[model samples]
Structure formats: C-alpha cells, structure tokens
Target: MTMSSGNGISFYMPRYDFTVRARWLERNARLIGVLKAAVPTQAIFSHVVVSGQTVGAVTRIRYDGPGVMVPRVFGSVFFYQPSQKINLCYGEITESATVNQFAEVIQEDLDALRDLGSKVWADTVANPVRHVVQVNIQEW
Candidate 1:
C-alpha cells in the first residue's frame, strides 16, 4: 500500500493489512516520533539538525485524511521512499547512511524526551503520551 499528498509527504507499506500496525509502530516509535516532530504539517523544514549536527529536513504535503495523531500516527521511513508519487516497496528497506543519521536523530529526540520529564523506554510503547512533544529543529 502506498499513499501520497502530492506536496511532499508520502507513505508506503508493502501490504494494506494494518492489523499489526500497532506492533510496527512500537518497533519504530522513536523514528516515527522524530519524523512526526520534524514534520508537523504540510510544510518543509530545511537544514534539519540535532545538537549541532545536520540531518535532513521534514516535508509535509497535502492530505485529505484526518489529522495524523500520535496514537494513530502512521508515517514510514523504511516501508517506502519519500516521494511525490505513491510507491510501495513492500518491506523494510534502509541505507547505511540513513540508518546512522536516524540513530543520531533518535538520540536527540530521546534527550529531548528526557528533558521534558519523560522516561526513555527500552521499549517505546512504554513512553508516555503526554511527553510526546514535537521537536522543532528545522532550519526553515
């Protein structure tokens, strides 16, 4: 399954069966949170960085669906390649550089989570909802 907003934001999954979606979210909660925080809406934040290092910007596009929420949050970094057109890769895929970059981003997000009086969970599912604040580290 693949979805796009035509602006910039894109989502893709190999299968449409979101029955295990919650499990998937739990596995990648930090990544999701970071991306969600990085890209709050249908706008692009350029020159994204954390602690003083540059990562990548977050881009939001047009979408008719209901607003994306934390619990219902569904954006992917591995399932699909971010693009204007909907493209389904059908499985988890990632590059070495992307992985390293994400590691840094997750670390930064984790620190922010702690500063906000939130517990860093070995399992993200345990993270409190109240502390799931959006990170504003965009250059634009």
Candidate 2:
C-alpha cells in the first residue's frame, strides 16, 4: 500500500499492514510532514517496512532529484513495537500501543527525526568523511 502527500512525499508499506494501521498513519500525518521538510529538497520517498515485530520508516531521495546518489535515511525514531521500547537514532523512547501516542512521544523528543534527517544529509553532502592512508615498508 502507498500514500502520497500533496508535496511529493510518498509512503509505502505492505497492504496488510496498511489495513491494520491506516489510522495510525493518518493520525500522524504531521510527523510525515515533518519528514517532508526535514530534507533540503522537496522530493522524498519514504517506505515503511515491517520486520518481526518492529516497523521502520525509511526515507530516500527521489530518483529524479539531484540527490539520487544519496543513500537512504531513516527516521530517528524508526522502530515501533507495541509494549516494547521504541529505539531512537541515539537512544530509546518509551513504549506505546497507539501510533498517535507514539507521535506525541516523538514530539517530546525535540524533533529527533528531523534532526537525524538533516544530519544525514549534511554528513553525506556537506561534510563527508575523509579517509587517509599511510604505508610503511618492513623487512621480513
């Protein structure tokens, strides 16, 4: 299943999952909006995947965009499992059953998802890591 926002951000997940948690996604539209604005550009594609009991919300640059080479970026608060603590990019958030409440919890985390998105973009483009190499000759 897929849901597209007016600003060119599209979300995808399994049809069964969507049927089960459609309301959750609907209630957290603001969170999706936050993700849409987290990146520098307006073209983003997000896919939600279910692994075991955890759900991950992954974002990537659109293929038609300038950042087509940019790797996928995940929301800071990606994993969501009822009755289990949701892990953040840097830490963990308290457990909750409803997705709406989860959004509230994330909001209390000072917009961690947005921060993570920006940081990933900066690290990938603005300030990429540089590797230095040194070689030494040895006699055996």
Candidate 3:
C-alpha cells in the first residue's frame, strides 16, 4: 500500500493465512512505535543512529542530515525476523522541506497502517479459504 500527501510512503507484506497475517501486522505496528521513540533530539540536519530489539524482532533506524546547506532529511526503519530468515517489514520517510516533517509523515503512515490491518482482517474473514487435499505416496 502507498500513500501520497505531499510526501510518499509505501508498505508491503507477503500473503499469509489470517492468523499469521494479523500477528505480523501487529508486530509491524509495534516496530513503528519503536522507531518513533528512537528519533533523534536535534533532528534537523543532524546525524543519528538508533537500534532496538524486541521479542523475535530487531529494528535498525537511522537519520542523516549532512549539513545545514542540505534541506533533506532521510530516515528508514528495517525490521527483521532472524528465525524466519526474512525482513518482516520496512518503512522509509523522506522530508525535503526546510522544516521537519517526519512527525507528520510517521503519523500518516501509522494511520494508513491501521487501515490496512483492518482491511486485511475484514477481507480474510469475509472470504475464507476452503480447500483440503493431502497426498501421501506409499512405497511397496
């Protein structure tokens, strides 16, 4: 899913059963909170790095602003599941304006995330998979 409001944010996840999907969605939301808490004190044109780990997940967040001459601020959060050997989720927010827009972007992303969670749940509940086929090969 992608949202464009003067800035752009996109979210993606692989298809899975409803129960599994819901668990992942909740985990992703929690990671977003972790990222927000890790925001640097002086975000404007500053270099900051924050990392945190939660149960079954690890997040790496970074904020970079080379100098006052530069007006762009780039931040990213990478959430990984080592046991699964895959990246559970990822989010990136960029602000080109002079002022800090990270807060607004994060808020928008969170709202969108909630919407997505609801949509996925509703979709799965409304239309559930109904099929069963178990094949067993016997050697004689």
Candidate 4:
C-alpha cells in the first residue's frame, strides 16, 4: 500500500516479509485504510507465505475419482507455531478423519522435527526415546 502526502507525493514504503505474532491489525485491514484517509501513511502486508504448519498429522490418502480408480489427497494439521503463550498446541487438521492423529511421535523423532516446538505431555512410552544413533569413534 502506498500513501500520498498533501503535496501530491507518495510516502516512503517498506515491505515486510516475515512471521509476526497474531496481531489485531491482521483482523482489521480496514483500519489501514482509515489511517490512510485521516493521515499520510501507508502499510503493506506482503503476501502471506505459509512457511509451514504444526499439526497433529500430515497424511496422504486415496479415494475413488471420476477418471481414476483412486485419487490422492494431502492433508495436514492446522495450528499456530510455537509461541510463548501456547504451551501445548493441537493441530486442527485441514479436514477431520483424513490424517492419522492417533500415531504418537516418539522422543527419538525430536531432532528431525526440531521446529515442531516442544511436546508437553507425561513422559510416557508413547512419547519415549526409541531410535539409537550409530557412531564409531577411534582414538589414535
């Protein structure tokens, strides 16, 4: 968004390309316009680049289709990224029952899913360590 000052010129514009915590402005784009009308300022929200999603699951399923015997559909859990307020997050998968939400992510899978934030649950086998690291060290 570009704003023009009284002299029939545009104000300096800046492009923001990054993730920002949920903000009130996100729900009110109209406020930006109001500010433009009342004052000489412009604000722009770069296209939303959905970096990634944290959910209960990501799944691929097959279903009957018109031309094909089975069609493939990709689904994921939709939820907010790990932030200070949300200690435990749940994924509202794109559609219910499409993804496998029952499967548990064992502790060993932590490194691979580092950005998965942190899992806050009772330290039970369902989320216990399983995988082992293979290493051979030789001292000379």
Leading candidate by lDDT: 2
The CA root-mean-square deviation of candidate 1, after full C-alpha superposition on the true structure, stands at 16.8
- In candidate 4, which residue pairs clash? none
Q: Local error of candidate 4 at 80, Å?
A: 16
The worst-scoring run of ten residues by lDDT in candidate 1 lies at 13-22
Name the lDDT value of residue 20 in candidate 3. Answer: 13
Residue-level lDDT tens digits of model 4 in 1-140 = 33232211121212111111111122222322332243332222111112222312111212221211111122211111222111112222132222211112233433333323222111111256532211111111
- Residue 49 of model 2 has an lDDT of 25
For model 1, residues 23-102, the per-residue Cα lDDT tens digits are: 12234444444444444333221221221122122344322322222211112223112431111111223422322111
Q: Is candidate 2 or candidate 4 better by lDDT?
A: 2
- After superposition, the stretches of candidate 2 with alpha carbons farther than 4 Å from their true spots are 1-23, 26-105, 130-140
The lDDT per prediction is: 0.24, 0.28, 0.26, 0.21
Worst 10 contiguous positions by lDDT, candidate 3: 131-140
| TM-score for each of the candidates | 0.20, 0.21, 0.23, 0.17
lDDT of 3: 0.26
Residue-by-residue lDDT tens digits, candidate 3, 54-134 = 111112343342212222222222332232111111123233323212222243354444443344434433347622211
Q: After superposing candidate 1 on the true structure, give the runs of residues whose Cα lies further than 4 Å from its correct spot.
A: 1-24, 43-140
Which one wins by lDDT: 3 or 4? 3
- Cα deviation at 87, candidate 1, in Å, is 7.9
Query: How many clashing residue pairs, candidate 3?
Result: 0
